[model samples]
Target: MSKLLNWFKQLDENLVKILLIGFIFFVPLWPKLPLKMVDYTYIAVRFDDIYLAILAFIFLIQLLRKKVLLNKKFILPFFVFLVAIFASFLWNAYITKLIRLPHLGLLHSLRRVEYMIMFFIASSVIKTKKDFFQVISYFFISVLIVILYSLGQKFLNFPAVQTMNPEYAKGYILYLTPDARISATFGGHYDLAIYLVLAIPMILSFYFAKVRSFYLYLFIGALLILLYTSSRSSFIAYFVATVAFLLFTRKFKFLIFVLILTAGLMFTTGEITKRFLKTFQVRRILIDDRTGAVYIGQTITTKELPAGSFYVKLKDQSKGDNLDTFRNQVVLERTREATISGEISTLVEEKKYMASLSANLRPVNTVVSDISLATRLQVEWPRAIDAFKKNPLLGTGPSSLTEATDGDYFRWLGELGLLGTIAFLNILFLILKTIWVGVNKLSFSEKLIGYGFIFGFFALFINASYIDAFEASKVAYTFWTLAGLYIGYYGLKYEKA
Candidate 1:
């Protein structure tokens, strides 16, 4: 027993650092497969959760034994944020009873902490510059694995396990259809796309700094995967972030090369371009005033309109006469199949419904949006705004907005309210501020990599406008981990300088 205790005591911070290195590969490359199901939510307790929980427990024990020291720089803000989360959860779950399931609400609140704990774990474990670079090399390898897996999914009929729906969350393996977006090891295409957006800039920075062919190949592969994901928001984020990083680093010639390469890849797929163009279009729709039934017409893709375009509702001039004129204006004959059941027999008839609906049909020209944006505008965003209106200070609570608001700002406002949002934003602000200050003291190559992190962060912020990228488990974990590593390295570099 004494020998075992001595051996345990000998286990040092290096063990934790090694695990953190493994984390860089584990979090992104591992598929989200459900190990246990959490009640009242589709979010299952996956292997990564179990892994992190164990890691956190070990870290805590180490801290207790004086084997490691905690970074206190973020404690205050993080504490306040935790307080806000619990306060909101308590208020909503018990007092007001806005949150129906108390356990789920608490779990939702704790999940935020779970997502962020890696930041401190990462920051505390970096003892030297070697540690930083070694972990980063592992990260590059992980990206390569992710890219290869994505290619496998695209060409080699690789199976995917996704959590986009409750059915998919049950750990079922799915084969993607030919036209389906590739998620690789991620829960969804959006998560994978955002991950690529965050990673590509950093890869480019390293390639430029070291002039390495391997990083260059990784960059190209990552871009191809990004195209395959076909997430418009991520595409936009990638373009903006890549451009900002290149221009800020004054890589003008390389900027042109990146632009040309990206353009060629984008055009080669044309999936993203087609989706962007299809976001809004002018269409003719016929409304039956009597039955309140709407019949949508063919899309006028040639006359593509900007989002929120005005509709032309033609005034019924001599209502009956106009209806007759519209019916006559229909060039093609349309038929509807109706099953008529008599006392003894059932008869199927094809009716000329277009001519018969002359009295009630009203034609109008309106702008129609694609399913994705329409759902957000019509349902998700409005629901979040309603929650915010209910409680401006604390909103409803975590899990109050259901699975997602599809927008991080709205999710924060709806779930955490103003106080929680501000506190969380403060944590981000401090991290960025620290990076900004400490990065300047580093060598030129290190400085570029640091700036790459900043731009990647900016890209995520842009992505957050339309996607809950930060809320995504894989993306969130990877992000906080990277933030911690960068800050830890920056602190060491600053001290050395």
Candidate 2:
């Protein structure tokens, strides 16, 4: 352990700077970064996971130069996870007779491997306090660029700037309000929202780090951007981070200040407050039959009357609980309409209709619910589970889930089988447990920082129930880096004193 620590302490600062520079490439790829360049590519049969591949090469060169030493001290389990996942992919390809998976598809097969390399860089390279602060500082500086550019896109109507694409410009710049929500340079609103959610915590950490007053202002500015995006997952992420931070610190005074400051901000920014309040309205619309049904059915502007019935089904006798009652009413009303119009009839008909209704309703519900309850668990999870059941040992290939199954868990089973899934699950449980234990050992301020990342991970995990954030390049990179930080901070048993 001392040898490992000493080796880590000798890591060259210049090499560390190169790794930080590599981080810059990723931000432009974020949807609506006001740039138009496809950040990754494939040549012939070879695929490049731009960020990961680049980082891996840099790390390798650094090791070769002896600027940093590569020792597999804390990386065994991560390696196992990578090997198991890749082996499963090869097994899936052999069984499924895919002829050839897309070159890019096969490229992502290295994602976990790339992530493990990042963990090594983070764990070994970030030894001294200066090295640690530099990493954190680089992160905030990059965030500043993101915030500034996103603001430029939102306010100045910055023409789309991309290295590869020019026609991708969005004219208006409001990021949080749903109608004309800006993607800046990203793929869409959701993409920008996801990046912002993950970055927000790190930005907040810098804000409280006592670096400068401008950081506090930047934090406020970022919060405004979040409000404008009106992304429920991001909002929930903020809430989760806040609650976890507070609970961990047990700082009542800070908690009260936060609540009061929040209320004050809501009072001051009528537009933002209106929109924040509007999310609850969205929740209301989701559950209400008359408004929600039209919204879900895409009949909000349809001149043609819907062929089916529209009404309510109160599942329970409960009152004063608006959302559940509204959902029940919608089900009942829709069922009655279906029966009256002969679209469907009887309890079986109602069940079928609701199930059909969910195909459309579920996406919105999932988006609001972080895609866990309505979509991931309800639809995709079952499908994935079935796929896993069929191939219990060496399941399916990477990206096979989108093609063959729907649930991530099932994707694990289909690609890796029950064996791979169990292995993956064990790794996940270990990481979460490690982070949780680390959180318990931190100073109050450090605990807040740790808690923020933990909340971000949980938020993404919940969001993954519907969408594939884990598979997404930007989210995936951020997750693994933070995971690495967590391991380094806690797993090393490095005493601050």
Candidate 3:
């Protein structure tokens, strides 16, 4: 077919520009179909890596023939950053070995360079606004598929391929009860949510630019998915990116629309919030008798309470009252109000535990009582800080930390140290600078490309504060490739001019 011939043309490495566009569509959403090794280490080669490798090999041969050139601005900083990545990696490896500390191996450390290479290839390949536009089409087409699958996954229990966790085993699909947050084709809900945080803002820009109504619908779908994720940090990131995009593009009316939509969603959101809020509230107060599970609705003196239970005096309440007593009273009052409001059936299982800290489980800092937040602050951050202090120039190597590096910036500081940190920042500075330059020169419809690059990147950056989103495979690959397209488009345009 003629379409097949055209596809061949697009895949041809001699036409590097077109081939890179093809890579954009195929790579990011490729299922994590990993190669199982006999040694028990899984080799997960992403499509981005495969296609880019092919592109590199083809371009290398062309380089010998003097048919193509890899050129771009920010070359100096980019290589320096690469060097920093390796140097910090090697330094940490040496230090960790000398100090007998943990470190991420060579493969994990060097793998980032592979992600960055697409930026260079993209910069080399794209020669016009048309090229960038075509590439954007490739990207969103893949996204639309992901969106459709994610929404579909909500109703129909589709089989998924995930190696990330035991919950997401080879034969399993990740599920949650009542309202299961959909992970779709991605590895997890957090991954899907962060990807949307970067993507939704970029897609929404098309609506304001009068590009098409289709993208607007896509944006709405993405927003629905984002809410379904229930990731608070991602919500904050998307909010920041949305505001930043509107302000930069000077589109205030849509901002108002977003605010109204958020208010609407808040009213309509069901059991998810109730269940989430309940985690912070006290539930049942046991009288130390497993058999005495009945609710008497009796007001007894503090002296009559169970021996093992906690008691604390409050400023407003009677002196002998405790947190459990306070919780029980609140629940009873609320229950009576709810009965008056509408009705909730009884005869459920007897409430067993209350979350409020009593005198027995008194924390050093009462205010920092959130268990999740407390763990991050008390355990992860301190461990990272100590790692950084040990080798301040370049901290412990990648994977050196004992647990997940939930905070990306700190991970860089702890793993790579100052040299790596500066390099990484410089890399971002250059990418942003390229996008900044490209935006001014674009036509109205085409300008969304630049807007997408700018705002989506900020969203990812914001997400990086709480998660290592930049290192996330899908986010990293697509981001670099888009930035590369922008840079390449800019270079081609300037050269002709």
Candidate 4:
């Protein structure tokens, strides 16, 4: 027992720092392979979970031994946020019974803590700027590997293990189709795209600060990967964040160069551009009043872009007929049923329909939205609103709305209500405040990096408006890890000054 205690006492902070460096590479590079499947959700307990658990255990021991000191910079907000999460869980699970499964709700609540705790662990290990830069160097190396693997997936037919669906979550290796977006080591393309949105700004900042060609090359590679991911929200977030970073850093001369490169890449990879154009279109739709049948006049070839249905009564059917229309579209029709001696009879009839419909039918021009945006607007967004309305304070609790809300704000509002949302936002507010104050104290290169991280966070906020970015494991974990390092480094500099 004494020997064991002595050995633990000898365990130093360097070991923890080394493990942190390893994690810098592991979280992004390692594929998400499920170790155990959980009920109610497809989100499985993976290798990363086990690794994080072990890391946390070791970190706890070091804290107990006084080898590492905790940073209490963002402690108050985190505590309040956690209280809100547990309060919501307890309210829904025991009081309201909105949470059908107590265990699932508890796990969902715990997962948030698991992701956030890394901030403290990362901060505890960074005692100096050297430690900060060393970890960042490993991070860039990991990014390079991720970019290379994405390229391999695009051209070399690399296999991927994705959790986009329940079946895929079972850990089957999938070879993506030629036109499929590259997810790299992430769960999906959106995850990959958001991750790049966070990293690209920092890469560019480093290049601009040091004028290093390697950093420039890395930026171009990451941008290419971002384009390949083909995530519209992340793409928009990337541009907004990059522009903000450059403007804040006063790198105005490089704006034209950045624009030319992005435009050229967008032109070369026209898939995303085409998707944007196809988001909304005016189309002719025929509706039958008698049978309540809807017929879309246009045919969609690619499954990637599906149109949303919207109907508006045409003031004049003649106006719809005047527009270019489908002359004769073949459709299945049902014949009237007749009863003879208590036996029902029916017939299937094939008919040709046109924009000029019968008196029982109405033809109108309706606007159709793409499936991606349509899902959020029609189903996911409304569902969240309904959940929020049910309990304006505590919400319907976590996991009540199934796997995704598509938007983080809606998810927070629907699951945790205003209290949870406000607390989490406070945490962000505190972090941003710390960054704003400490960034000026940093050296030239460090200051540029700080600016990059600040804008990267801004980009994520834009992404969260459309995507549940903070909910995703890879992106969320990376964000918190980098954020911790940034805060830790800032604290070190502030104390020194």
Segments in model 1 whose C-alpha atoms lie over 4 Å from true places: 1-11, 287-295, 298-361
Comparing 1 and 2 on TM-score, the stronger one: 1
TM-score computed on alpha carbons, candidate 4: 0.90
In Å, residue 258's CA in model 2 sits off its true spot by: 3.4
Sort all candidates by TM-score, best to worst: 4, 1, 3, 2
Return the candidate ranking by lDDT, descending. 1, 4, 3, 2
Name the runs in model 2 displaced over 4 angstroms: 1-13, 24-48, 98-105, 159-178, 205-212, 260-382, 392-394, 403-418, 428-448, 489-497
TM-score of 3: 0.76
Q: How many residue pairs clash in all the candidates, one count each? A: 0, 35, 1, 0
Query: 63-102, model 1: which lDDT tens digit per residue?
Result: 8877677878888989999999999999999988999998
**Winner by TM-score:** 4
Q: Write the per-residue lDDT of candidate 4 for residues 1-497, one digit (tens) a residue.
A: 99987776555647687788888788888888899999877889999888889889999998998778888768888999999999999999999999999989999999999999889988888888788888888888899999999999999998888989999998999999988999998999999999999999888877877788988899999999999988888999999889878887788889779999999999898788887787786666666776776666555664357666544443544564442243233222222122333223432211222222344555676766776787898799999999999998889998888888899999999999999999999988888788777878767877887888888899999999999999999998899999998888887887786
- RMSD for all candidates, in order, please: 5.4, 9.8, 10.3, 4.2
Model 3 lDDT per residue over 385-464, tens place: 88889888877766676436677888888877888888889889877876666566667655765676688888888888
Tens-digit lDDT track of model 2 for 74-99:
45666677777767666666656531
TM-score of each: 0.87, 0.66, 0.76, 0.90
lDDT (C-alpha) at residue 207 in model 4:
86
Instruction: At residue 351, give the lDDT of candidate 4.
Output: 22
Compared with the true structure, the alpha-carbon lDDT of candidate 4 equals 0.83
Each model's lDDT comes to 0.84, 0.55, 0.65, 0.83
The TM-score obtained by model 2 is: 0.66
